[model samples]
Target: MFVSELMSTRLITVELDDKLSAVKEIFESVNIHHLLVIESKMVFGVVSDRDLYKALSPNIGTRTETSKDTATLNKRVHQIASRRPIVLPVSATIEEAIYIFNTHNISCIPIVDHEMEPIGIITTRSILKALDEKKITLLATCKTQ
Candidate 1:
């Protein structure tokens, strides 16, 4: 399978200047794991939920340091987002995508066009779903044999 076939076109994006508080809100509201950071309609970086958690204070549940957390949230998205991500061409194979995922320690890859414009996002979950489908096919083939 190719990445373009599996990549998700429905994306949630944020500008580099957007606040971390806004990012937190989007993650909380959408149950999404990553947000693409775009500038001038071109992808600049990617911010994962882990990145948000790492950047924020751990005393978030204590309420006492809520102010600290809020201050952290006031940071710009570009400050927290990882820049120069490993992007995949829309034609990249699933094997290539998985290799990049495993080798790069990245959970997501922003699929891009020739112009470096993001067309979609591919995640570990998407790869897993494809694997599951292949597993089902293999199991059925074994049963028939």
Candidate 2:
């Protein structure tokens, strides 16, 4: 199967100049794990939920929160994003994605167009979900036979 077949088309993109607070808000309100960082309509980096967590102070929103802790939110996405990320074409196969995941430390791969603009995203979670669905289908087929 092609990566495009299983990729999540709903993308949440942020700019280099954008603040971490806005990214935090989006993550808190959604069920996503990664956000693409774009520039001039081209994808250049990625910021995962873990990255945001590490960049922010643990005391945020707590009674012990200080002005300095709040200042961390003012940091730009580029400051914490993984730059020059590895990307795959939408036409790439699922096996290729699996290979990349196994060899790289990254959690997700951005699916891009010819111009390097992100069209979709594929994560380890997506691959696992696809595998689970395929397993269920195979089990059903065997039972029918």
Candidate 3:
């Protein structure tokens, strides 16, 4: 199978200059875990929920919140994003994505075009889900034969 087949095209993006506060709002309001950071309409980096958690103070949004804690929100998306991400082309195979996941510590691989513009994203969960569905389909086909 190709990466494009299993990848998610519903991209949630943030610019390099976007604040962590904005990213926080997006994460809270949306079901997404990763946000693609773009520059000049090209994929620049990736920021995950875990990165935000680690960058921000735990005191944020609490009664004990301090100015120092809230200051973290003022940080830009570029500050915490994983730069120069390992990307894949649409034609890349699922095995290639798996190899990247295994060899790197990244959770998602942005699928880009020839210009390095992101078109989709593939995550470990997506791959596993696709594999499970394929297994079920195969079983069903075998039983019907």
Top lDDT hit? 2
Q: Residue 35's C-alpha lDDT in candidate 3?
A: 97
* Residue 51 local lDDT, model 2: 99
Candidate 3 error regions (>4 Å): 135-145
lDDT of candidate model 1 versus the reference: 0.87
Whole-structure CA lDDT of model 2? 0.93
User: Which candidate would rank higher by lDDT, 1 or 3?
Assistant: 3
Write candidate 1's Cα lDDT for 102-143 as tens digits.
898899999999998999999999888877777324435646
Instruction: Look at candidate 2 and tell me the lDDT of residue 58.
Output: 98
Answer with 2 or 3, whichever has the higher TM-score: 2
Q: What is the C-alpha RMSD of each candidate to the true structure, in Å?
A: 3.5, 3.7, 3.8
- C-alpha lDDT of candidate 3 relative to the true structure: 0.92
What does candidate 1 score on TM?
Answer: 0.87
Q: Check candidate 3 and list the clashing pairs.
A: none
Estimate TM-scores for all models: 0.87, 0.92, 0.91
The Cα error of candidate 3 at residue 89, in Å, is 0.3
Residue 44's C-alpha lDDT in candidate 3? 97
> Please, what is the whole-model Cα lDDT of each candidate in the order they appear?
0.87, 0.93, 0.92
